[model samples]
Target: MFAAIIAAGVCSCYYDSEEGLYPSISSTCDTTNVTYSGKVVPIFANNCLSCHSNARAASSGGSVALENFADVSAQAASISAAINQTGPLSPMPKNGSKLKACLITTFDIWVRNGKPNN
Candidate 1:
């Protein structure tokens, strides 16, 4: 009985991987190679498209369409401010949670990179 109890406790007491317990450590944000098509569009697609797509911009995105590169580049300043929740304007993803730190970094980097078509 003592041996069984010891074995059970030992088996159950293993440490969880860092990635599982604290994602930030292992899930470092990839900031080295952010690109407009490779990184920016996908973020918008996942987080902003429901309201910010071209088709719904007038009614849902407050006329802020992000479905294409030109539109996003035109709105770059506003996008940066909104995503960081820094300006007097309401934060973007409107009522949603702030984007992940990595995602924000990625967008900011892309903007700094001139919102390139690449």
Candidate 2:
């Protein structure tokens, strides 16, 4: 019984690492050449489009349309603020989890590059 208890204690002492739990969460994020269509759009599609899409914008996105380049460009600064969960703006994605660090970095790079349409 004592040996069984020792084994149980050892087994229970397993460490949980963020990277180990989230294998898909990459450590190295390449932010080079970030673009509106290629990088930005896909990020929006995955995290923001459900509510901020053209169709859903009116009813669920608080009328904030992120479905296209023009709309996104207009709100680029605020979008960046929201994604970073900083400044006075509310954190984006409402009840959803914050975007991955790599994704946020990519968005920041895109915005810094003058928010190109490409």
Q: Candidate 2 on 1-118: residue-level lDDT in tens? A: 9999998876665335434333454667766678788889999999999999999999999999999889999998999899989889989878999988888878877876788889
Per-residue alpha-carbon lDDT of candidate 1 for residues 4-113, written as tens digits (9 for 90 to 100):
99988765654453233224522466666788888999999999999999899999989889999999999899898999898987798899999987787788778877
* Total colliding residue pairs, candidate 2: 0
Give model 1's TM-score versus the native structure.
Answer: 0.75
- What's model 1's overall lDDT? 0.83
- Each prediction's TM-score versus the true structure: 0.75, 0.75
The C-alpha stretches of model 2 lying farther than 4 A from their native spots are: 1-27
List the RMSD of every prediction in angstroms. Answer: 11.4, 10.5
